[model samples]
Target: MSYKSHTVLLIPGIFDRGSSLLRMQRALAEEGFDAHYIHLRYNSGWHGMEHLSSQLMAKIEKLVKKETTCTLVGFSMGGIVARYYLQAMSGINRVHKFISIASPHYGSYWAHFLPYKGGKQLRVGSEFLRGLNQSVRVLEATEPVSIWTKYDVTIMPHSSAKLEIGTSYEVPVILHRLMPMSSKVISLLKKEVITGMG
Candidate 1:
């Protein structure tokens, strides 16, 4: 598919408003790509990840039924949610590239700080995260990329952001929330988006 025909679906992190990804969306649009931000109502992690992923699939289905498969851009919890859609809900066939920014692929210790059903699920060694890792063991069709910072305070052990199955990039940024908006990060992402279309 040509880069012009490519679409990007951006998902925000847990408890984060979709507007958090506004800068990235606008950057993508300005680059001549059809970029869209997904607004998830149940922002708390308390809801089932798969349930949320299904909701995302519904929105994805509505957007690219006949068009080229989209590139999935997920930040933090949003990355995990997008992974659930890909690994558990057969989303690989619908997406050409998968980019995760500062997501906890291996459960985070900081998750224990939050007191919600979703937080419990994200805690280190939670059944949900285990299941997610198991599903990723068999992932196919789409190429996955993980982007993270060495100084992230949100995802403790920061290393938890790294993935074992696909490409991973460790950046020098200091905060987790700024991953999506960083110009350096955006440059890397733009390259991935264009490369994945091939």
Candidate 2:
């Protein structure tokens, strides 16, 4: 059977290994979308978001060479990584759709508890956040979708996951890490990607 022209890449949250996104990848495959996950060089929170974003960009570059279109499904910190590549690194041209699940687009209060460049960047009002916010318009070139849970405990003030330029959804899933595994989130993500293709 001929596959869809687009491929979906899954970026996992901070400290999460690439394998953590297996459930998401499987869901996308079942929906007839080619899905893959990147093995981030650094899974720790010690590096800056830019560092992680660079790795993600490399994967996107390689994938786009084979597929006509690409979609990014970032989980938690993975969303931030994709944003950096899209907003700061001029990745909008490479991506057709962006889906953020439980990400901290507006910065999270708990980020201050960690002592690392990446962690600090997640704190509210960080320079990284300032730059990301300023380039929010870049996302307009591609479809953006923000999926978050109201009961997330990790991203305090979970509303930080919402984006100004995209459609937002709130799920009843209580745990932050379980978002990708939630069928509701996966279904929404598939709908967005397919709709964007149309």
Listed in order, each prediction's TM-score against the native is: 0.93, 0.94
Candidate 2 lDDT, 1-198, residue by residue in tens? 123356888999988887668877887798788889877868665878889889888887787664365888889989999999998887877788889999999899989988899889999889988899998988986778999988998988888998988799999998988898898997898889889788
Score candidate 1 by lDDT. Answer: 0.84
Scored by CA lDDT, what does every candidate get? Answer: 0.84, 0.85
Q: List, residue by residue over 93-191, the lDDT tens digit for candidate 1.
A: 788788999999888898998887778877888888898888786554567889999899889878889888778888888888888989888888888
Specify the highest-lDDT model's number.
2
Q: Best TM-score goes to which candidate?
A: 2
Least lDDT summed over 10 consecutive residues: which range in candidate 2?
Answer: 1-10
Candidate 1 lands at a TM-score of 0.93
Residue 34's lDDT in candidate 2: 86
Residue 26 of model 1, lDDT score: 84
